[model samples]
Target: MHLSIIAGSSGLVGNNILNQLCEDNHNVIAINRKPISGLHPKTTELVIDFESFLIDGSLPACNHAFICLGTTMKIAGNKNNFRRVDFDYSLDIAKKAFESGAKKLTLISSGGADSSSKNFYLRVKGELEDAIINIGFESVNIFRPGFLTGAGGRKRATSEKIFMKLAKFLDLILIGSARKYRSINAEVLARKMVSTLKSKPGVNYYYYDDFIK
Candidate 1:
């Protein structure tokens, strides 16, 4: 019975989150770069050019904001462009949502994220987490699941599909502490996000156990 803002609705995790949000009866404002169709009845879709003044005062007052936008260095063309999407764009949207009265924030971050890591990708993820944590939201949920499965169509490559299927199957044997390293279904994480809309104040990190459960 709350309004939520969801950016990156075209992504595997975000799309699933959108579906679960609607099923839970929460009104959603879904932001996408391109036009889309066939979403749930509770969703209001906005095709936006991120920085243009289009969304300036148009976004509704929301209870929570979920940011699922991210891209690999290869897909983004370089580290700079990758930062533009993962860091710049994400932080911008978070600020906007907070300004519009969203008190809770949910972000889809990768596992092994470290601000000082030698790995560039994980470093960016860590930096984004750092930026949003201090953005004045009452609650922030960070999901750092490893090897996100069920991204079959999003990957759109034969080898990638095979890898994801293998990862999904391997989830059976990943037990105990090793469970944190297990591949998790995007839909499971999405449901977890929707279920935690009213988490306690401050930051919460969900690994395989908390999110996949």
Candidate 2:
């Protein structure tokens, strides 16, 4: 069984990934800002300030590190705070995991990520991808699913819900090269991320087709 460390254990995609990891009976170290309950018996959770942890905390040895940490500009209140969560905190955890001897790394990125993109959000995602790739893990998996859904009970704006419903219809029409832009469920993407950890060395990017497959 793998001993893995997962950051962002409280988000939609991250929470699902955590569940999958625990259900497989793998040993998990879940890091979050606050404590969470109802986790599997195999999971251990840590609550701490990310910036402080990065400066002083060290991780135990792990085979894989999964980073699902991210924040939106709106919720973050500004771009700097958004980057601190999405880029700074995420990169710091990856560094700690590497120092702890993790061979594989899995990250939850987004569709349309490009470092040189004019879009700020996509640019940050792309920059994070490049930074993580340079960490020299034995294997790296980056999932870029668009329009993620399937985290139940969270309040969403009505327009957002409508767009999600629309994604189902669009999924059918987004064929061929466009299939990568199709919407994917958070749980589906999490399962794919967990199953592919043993992939061959080198960086791998997964889109909607990759997750659904």
Candidate 3:
């Protein structure tokens, strides 16, 4: 199947997803701000500034689209900039892909996404999910994985890095609570996302454990 991916070549999830899609023999187009290196023949990279990317009627036809664009506040160094990358850029790509005849959309959200959440990160993610749902896609799969374990171009803050190290032990005990913190390998999430796209068409939401399961 033909697939279009936005932001799956930089972060751990996106990079793994892109590689898996290529291995599956699917035609994949990767859109990002910078060129991706060492991709398979089935993969094509499109580099353009996200802030001024013009869909302008020029996009490859695809059956599915994946939105994996995200950034942390530390990396962005500004809340607004972080939101722009994590929310605005993702929405823009989804809107454009939908307009370009893509039907299925898979998004990688956070674990505690809630529109009314007190946490800024989760609130933003929740808001983005709501906005995407309102955009009217035929099928939407939202995967919320916790403490992603993978290597990426972006690095976590020192505090988050320490928290992740500690969470490794806690994750074993907090297996089934709403506040349960589970860590999923980025490769695992990537495979699941692709599998979901290939399997069926439905509006599905998966939390942290569910993603790995």
Candidate 4:
């Protein structure tokens, strides 16, 4: 039996991936701080304090794990809090998952993510990507989507909404290499991630163009 574990199952992309996995009849373990509303035969909800996840003794062995947990500085309230979620919590979970026998791990990252970036958010994401890669999963697929559009009751700041709207409108005009910078829907991203499970053992990177494909 192939089991899949998803962190941040309550978020937009995570929720979509959880539902997609269930629909594919894959057994899934959903990890979240709070309960996610959904009922599926192959779904197991694991609610826990992310900070103490190392000692939780509840992690189930899985074939693959998806890291979807993320937050912004505004919502996290401070730079320290933001780094805790985006960097500390994610890397810790990745390490724990790696030790749990998950052969493949997929990360939902962002475009322009660079550990040496001047932007705080991008730098944090880049750092997490680097750390996870070093964990040495048999297969590590990093998806760097530009802007995401989807419905999951996820709250977005005014500026974010404006940017999303602009990206959505501009998506139609983006072609060829330009598509790599276009906005992609959350559901689409989830579907692609699941579909790519058969990928060979190695680290792979996907950008906006890859998302459209």
Best by TM-score: 2
Question: Stretches of candidate 2 above 4 Å error?
Answer: 152-155
Instruction: Give per-residue CA lDDT, model 3, range 18-54, as digits (tens).
Output: 8888898888888877777787899888887876774
Query: Would you list the clashing residue pairs of candidate 1?
Result: none
Which candidate, 3 or 4, has the higher TM-score? 4
- lDDT winner, 2 or 4: 2
TM-score of each: 0.91, 0.94, 0.90, 0.92
Name the 10 consecutive residues with the lowest summed lDDT in model 3. Answer: 51-60
lDDT of each: 0.85, 0.88, 0.80, 0.86
lDDT of 2: 0.88
* Model 4 per-residue lDDT tens digits across residues 130-159: 999999899999999988887873688789
Question: For residues 61-152, could you state the per-residue lDDT of candidate 1 as single tens digits?
Answer: 88899999987766889999999899988988898889889999999998889889899999999999999998999999999988877752
Clashes of each: 0, 0, 1, 1
What's the distance in Å from true for residue 69, model 3? 0.7
lDDT of 2 by residue, 5-97 (tens): 889888888888889888888899988998887878898887878889878988888899999998777779998999999999999999999
Ranking by lDDT: 2, 4, 1, 3
Clashing pairs in 2: none
